[model samples]
Target: MAKPQDLPLELLQFYLTAPYPCSYLDNEEARSQVLAPNSPINSHIYSELVRHGFRRSGSFTYRPHCDQCQACVPVRVNVEEFIWRRINRRIFKKNQDLTVHHQRLVFKEEHFQLYLAYQQARHPKGDTDTDSKEQYVHFLIHSPVNSELIEFRLNNQIVMVSVIDYLDDGISSVYTFFDPTQPDRSLGQFNILWQLNLCRTLTLPWLYLGYWIKECRKMNYKIQFQPLEGLIDHQWQPLAFAQE
Candidate 1:
């Protein structure tokens, strides 16, 4: 593993944010090591940052920097050796009807509408459920790297949308939102399966899935893809060893 300081990024600086309530865990607090705002982060610099367990949210690159807990383990899937479980295969089969379209990082009313509905349906109790159009744009559309917006449609109706960043070594699944009404379709799992295929198509070896917390039920889905690796003690290791 290489230190982030050794990366070829010039004038790159990191600062720890004030502790706040943890989003993934209950009754806990969390902090993040955020890259300096307005830092010149391009695809090359971001690729190195991501390799070091950092993730992009809007124009910010950050990683979990909790003081007492190391629950947020950065994880990625090895595309070459990813095991397609029965459930994964079923999910792929189920979403075979969805048509995928790659779009630029421009704002789309249709995408915003779906995103709003998804937030309301999936996370009614969450703060983002009531986000305005400006907030949506700032969160998902604003980027400083080579990012892409992909829409998954079924019969001309938008069903899901994914924001992904293309790194030198692989594709990063930044954020995904789907039609929460069709839970039986398992669009979320299908999204990961689709990303794996996209990685293979691009000849990339990894698919960054961001942080995974075992104690968080929502994040447990990340481990469903077998042979996952997690960043532990600054080293990437198998999920089992990383958890330990």
Candidate 2:
């Protein structure tokens, strides 16, 4: 594969992957239009691709190219204009003591255990529930560009970890998992709020939240962030939400 800059100016090389199980949708298949592998996709090149709805996982960058489905809509938060309402503010206040530590993209035994427990509780009998350390490392640790493993601690005990990718215009939320025993704390919601604050603190303009499917309740939580932009028809259209 060629580097991003070395690719043709007008047409980038992309290959369609074989049909695979759709992780988000039940009883359906999924396909991806993956950008050519073995290419150097740095932050600068990735920023351009992200604007066109591509998301990164490990070293591969891909977008949904399903034959008959377009339900996975790429959405991003306009951090500069994000409306923080009373509920969100309360969540922040509650999680004020969450000490965040940023680390390199390396695997930790504790992190892997937390991942296992999280999947066991939330996604048992799923593909990731049986993931080994090697699989975990391959899924989250290996990256070509700037990536971070953010740990959120409460009272000096690790409770959550967020894997994020820093891009030119904003930060991409790669994945996150937390101690499932503390459901009342709403750590998942708080994690996104923290990342939103990080975007503002870093003077970034957008926070890519990956794909949001209106039909999937598990994926619909992203819409809670107001004034988002969704890639529809290859155009970033401003989205409006009713007041909570």
Q: How much is 223 displaced in model 1, in angstroms?
A: 0.8
What residue pairs are clashing in model 1? Answer: none
Model 1 error, position 202 (Å) = 0.7
| lDDT for each residue of candidate 2 in 1-244, tens digit (9 for 90 to 100) | 7666555424657899999988888888999988887555777788888889999888888999999899899999999899898999998899898898999998888888889989899888777534888778878998878889999988888899999999989999999999999987889989999999999999999999999887787976788888888999999987654122
Which candidate gets the maximum lDDT versus the true structure? Answer: 1
**Model 1, global lDDT:** 0.89
What is the C-alpha lDDT profile of model 1 across 182-237, one tens digit per residue? 99999999999999999999999999999898888888778888789989999998
Off by over 4 Å in 2: 1-11, 128-130, 241-244
Clashing residue pairs in all predictions, respectively, total 0, 0
Per-residue error (Å), model 1, residue 13? 1.0
